[model samples]
Target: MTNSSAKTRAPLSRPIIAGVVTALVGFTSSFAVVLTGLAAVGATPGQAASGLLALSLTMGIACIVLATRYRMPITVAWSTPGAALLAATGLVEGGWPAAVGAFLVVAALILLTALVPQIGALIASIPASIAQAMLAGVLLPLCLAPVTGLALNPWGVAPVAITWLIFARLAPRWAVPFAFVAATVVVIIGVVTSGKTVDPALLIPQLEWTAPTFTLGAVIGIALPLFVVTMASQNVPGIAIMRSYGYEVPWRPAMLVTGLGTAAGAAAGGHAINLAAISAALAAAPEADPDPRRRWVAGLSTGISYVLLGGCAAASAALVLLAPPAVIPAVAGIALFAAFGSSVQQAIDDPGERIPAVVTLLVAASGVAVLGISAAFWAIVAGLLVRGVLHLGRR
Candidate 1:
């Protein structure tokens, strides 16, 4: 009895440590992207901080609830791809409030997907190649930031790029987080050199709520594309990853929890939260614990850590706000390199899909807005149209 008790307690610490690391890595690696996305869509610094705080709290709560209730290592995260999509989409009609409205629309769509099976089926029917092509196109411009920043502000961007390169070759998983640290150092040095001081008051987290206003352009341009990317890139892949680890995720419950969390956060400027894809392994893998049954503790611990991290959202946002122009964007860009490569590979994997994929990529990279709709929506339309034309009667 003593041996069994000791054995059980011993493994608990591993999962707990794994959970903390997951939260740290996941938050640090991509929070820059979240801030960049929110600012791009016209959010003020206060509102952007609120968005980050809301996302952290909501997803953390979702993870705790899901993991505890289901007894599985089901982790939750903000949609990084969806945030990238917002960064690419930029400001839509009616500015930040409309973007907030679009966020709410995405939340509703996610809820609908859980309640109505057909909605998810329709999204699933979209060709993987086309969907990925659109994603690749959206990522292209943002991914170019590192190069552009290097040319524009080498002093600030070089340290970040070099740190990322070194770590990417050695410790691939921690590369982005390290780059962020380097960027933060650069920001601090610049502040000191310029005799500028950061206001302590700005570092305190506060929620800034925006009343949402719906518009046709924001709905089609931001909401639809965001929903598609979150589903295709985050939620679906997350489920598959967990299944590969021999855990059957409860889909409806997961969707409902994420959907409701998203809705709760939308007014506070949060974009979307969903199942974790890339970071799910940190909590669910064998390294988290030899016993699969105990891995859920890691997920629970991750949620708690994230909730605590929410307190730092204002400070994180303040750092980005103070970051010398290209520094933050460069970090955001390097953090996305892995995602960009995967998207491009999957976008043009099929011989027949190459032309349509290229077309989509070009259109999305062009950053064109027609009839107030952003390039992302048009990229999808253009890809599907070209694909349909080429395959006409081929079947």
Candidate 2:
């Protein structure tokens, strides 16, 4: 009896450790982008902290519920790409309240996708090249932050960049997380040298709810683009990754859970939560467990870790609030390098779609706003119009 119990406990340990690693990697890697995105859309520092906490709690709960129910290593995450879109779109016609409304709209759209099969099919019918091109365009300005920050604040940004480059060669998986570590160090040194004191009260986690106020411009500019990005870059890819790992995720339940999670968090400033993309493999892969059936333990562990990490959201947000200018943005940029590369690659992969894709990229990268709508919406419009014209009369 003792020997059998030991064997059972021994195999379980590996997956539990993998789950903790997944949460750590997932949280530390892109929380900066979330903060940056929230701030760009007119969230105050306190509000941004609230957003982080909301996302952490909601997605953590989501992972726990889905993984346990399906007995698969299904993980949920805050939408990193959607956050980037918010950052690029900036303050919309109706300010922060409007942005919150846009978040709610995205939630409704996601729920609709789950309830009505045609909605998901419509989103799926969007050309991959065009979708990826718009994302690439939106990401371009952000990816330039490190280069531009190096020029503007070399002392602060250099160390982060060097750390990232070193780890990128030695351990690619940890490069961005290491860069964030370096940035934290830089921020601490800056604080010490400048004799600035951080408020202890600010470190305590709290949610600040905003009553949403919808506007047409925000709907078109922020809500639509955010939904598209979350679906194309996060949710869809997340499903494909799980399928590759031999887990047939129940589509409706997954959508319903994430959509409901997004709705619950929207008022607290979270932009969106969706299925995990890049970090999905961390929990689902064979490395998580020799036996695939046991890997769901990792997913449960990840959820619990994230719930605990939610307690630190305020501290993380305070750090970003206190960091010297350009340092945080630099970290955010390094964290997104993989995503930007992937987007650009997919955007131009097809010879036939190259022109429309390029058109979308150029329009989105231009940062043009027409009558309060952001470049992202215009990029989609331009790409589809060009494609329709070029393919005229083709069967």
Q: On residues 248-314, what C-alpha lDDT tens digit does candidate 1 reach at each position?
A: 9999999999999999999999999999999999999999998898999999999999999999999
Please write out the lDDT profile of model 2 over residues 101-218, one tens digit for every residue: 9999999999999999999999998899999999999999999999999999999999999999999999988999999999999999999999999889999999999999999999
Candidate 2 ranges with C-alpha deviation above 4 Å:
1-10
Write down the worst ten-residue block by lDDT for model 2.
Answer: 1-10
Q: Alpha carbon lDDT of residue 370, candidate 1?
A: 99
Show pairs that collide, candidate 2. none
